[model samples]
Target: MTSTAATTEATEKWSGQLRANGRRVTKQRLAVLTAVEHLPHAVADDVAAAVRGDLPDISLQSVYVVLADLTEIGLLRKIEPPHSPARYETRVDDNHHHAICTSCGRIEDVDCAVGHAPCLTPENTHGMTIEIADVLYRGTCADCAAQAS
Candidate 1:
C-alpha cells in the first residue's frame, strides 16, 4: 500500500472505526480512504476516477464496495444534497454541514455550531435512530453572487 503519513493518521481513526463496526482492514479500503482524504466531498464516480490513478486495476465495483464498506463503518460520510449525486468525505467526527452553490454546483464545508457529533437534534424524532444531523444550505456562492451583481 502506498501510505502517506497524513493518510495513515486518518486511516488510523478509520481502522479503529472499522474494527469497532466489525469490518476488516484491506488494501481497497486504504485506496478508497486515501482518495477521500485527498478529495473530500467527492462523488462516487469521482473517487473511482481518483483511485484508478493509483491502483490501475481497481474496478469501479471495487470502489463502490470500499465506499459502501467505509460508509457502513462510519469512516466516511455520505452527503446527498438534493438534485446531486451522493458525495463522500473522510472527516467523520465533526458533524459538519455543507453549503451548495446553485449556479456553480460547488459545495463547501461548515463545521457544526455545536462542534461535535450529532450537532443538532431534530424537533421530531418520529421514533427513528439518529446518528447525525446535516445541513445543506443552498445559495449562490461568492463568485456566482458577484457575477449576478
Candidate 2:
C-alpha cells in the first residue's frame, strides 16, 4: 500500500483504539501516534519535532502526556536504556528484546528466539510466575565495526 494510505489506515486504527479506551481523540494525540509509527524507537524530542511538521504549536509537555497515556493503554512500548533517553515504538503484544550499538547508540528490535513472548526458560523460578522477559544486547553495529576496521 502507498505510504499515505497506510498512514490513514493507521490513524483510523489508533483513533478507534482511543475511543475504545474511552479517551477522546484529539489532533495532538493522533499526530503523536503517527510520529511514533513513522519513527519507532524515537525519543520524546524526536516525536515532538515530527509532530511539529503538522502541529507547529504542540508543546513538548503535550507530547510527553500523549506518550505516557498511549503507553499506559498498551498501544505503545517504551524502552529505557541506561544513560539514554527513553524511546517509544508501536510494536507491542509480542515480548521482544533489543540490540544496542555501544559505539553509536542505535537500537533495533530483536524477536524472541523461540517465536513467542517470554522466550527464556529459567531453571529456577523461585516460586515466581514469569510473564515477560526484557533483554538488551550491546555491541557495535555493522557500520560502527566497519568504521573501526
Candidate 3:
C-alpha cells in the first residue's frame, strides 16, 4: 500500500482505539500513540521527540499526560526496568515479558516462558487468582558481549 494510505489506516486505527476506550480523539493523543507505535519500548522523552515532528508546539508534560492516559486505558503498556525510565509500547494485548541488557540497557521483548497467561507460577498465591506476570530478564546482549570481548 502507499504511504499515504498506510498513514490514513493507522490514524483510523488509533482514533478508533481512543474512542473505544472512552477518550476524546485529540491530535496530541494521536501523535503520542503514533510515536509509541513507531518506537516501541520508547521512553516519554523519546516519544515527545517523535511527536514534536508532527506537533511542534506540544510540550513534554503533555506527552507524559497522554502517555499515562493511554497506558491507563490499556492502549499502551508501560514497562519499568531498574534504574531506567519507564518505557511505552503498543503491545498490550498479550502477556509478554522483556529482556534488558545489563551493560547497554537495551530492552527486547521475550515471549512467555511457559504455557498460558501468567506463565510463571509462584510457589503460593495465598488464594488469590493470578491473571498475569511481568518478568524481566537481564543479560549482556550480543553487541555488548562482543564489545566486551
Candidate 4:
C-alpha cells in the first residue's frame, strides 16, 4: 500500500483503540500516533516535529501528553535508555528487546532470542510472577561500526 494509505489505516486503527478504551480521539492524538507509527523509537521532540507536518500548530507538550496517554493505554511502548530521552513506538504486544547504538543513539527492535514471552528466565522473581522482561542491549550499529573501522 502507498505511504499515505498506510498512514490513514494506522490512524484509523489507533482511533479505534482510543475509543475502545473510552478515550476521546483528537487530531493531535492521531497525528502523534501516526508519527510514532512511521518513526519507531522516535523521541518526543522528533514525534512533535512529524506531527507538526500535519498539524502546524501542535505543541511539543501536546505531543508528550499524547505519547504518555497512548503508552499508558498499551497502544504505544515507551523505551527510556540511560542518559537518553524516552522514545516512543507502537510495536508492543510482544516480548521484544531493543539494540541501542552507543555512538549514534539509534535504536532498533530485536525479537526475543528464544521466541517467547518473558524471553529471559530470572533466577528469582522476589516472590512475584514475571510477565514481561525488558532488556536493552547496548552496542554500536552497523553504520557506526563500519565508520569506526
Against the true structure, whose TM-score is highest?
3
What is the lDDT ranking, best to worst? 3, 2, 4, 1
| TM-scores of all candidate predictions against the true structure | 0.82, 0.93, 0.95, 0.93
Candidate 3 has an lDDT of 0.94
How much does candidate 1 score in TM-score? 0.82
The alpha-carbon lDDT assigned to residue 72 of candidate 1 equals 81
Clashes of each: 0, 0, 0, 0
User: TM-score of the candidate numbered 2?
Assistant: 0.93
| Clashing pairs in model 2, backbone N/Cα/C closer than 3 A | none
Please, what are the lDDT tens digits per residue for candidate 3 over residues 95-124? Answer: 999999999999999988885798888999
lDDT of 1 by residue, 1-149 (tens): 45577666877876776677888877677778888988989998999999888788989888988898788877888999898898999877777899999999999998898977688888999999888887888999999999999
| Model 2 bad stretches (over 4 Å) | 124-128
**lDDT: worst 10-residue window of model 1:** 1-10
Q: Clash pairs of candidate 1?
A: none
- Collision count of model 3: 0
Off by over 4 Å in 3: none
- Over 47-141, each residue of candidate 4 has an lDDT whose tens digit, in order, gives 99998999999888888888998899988999989999999899998999999999999898999998998999999889989988999999999
Better of 2 and 3 by lDDT: 3
Candidate 3 clashing pairs? none
**Between 2 and 4, whose TM-score is larger?**
4
lDDT of 2 by residue, 1-149 (tens): 99899988988998999999889999998999899988999999999999999999999999999999999998889999889999999998799999999999999999998987689978998999998788999999999999999
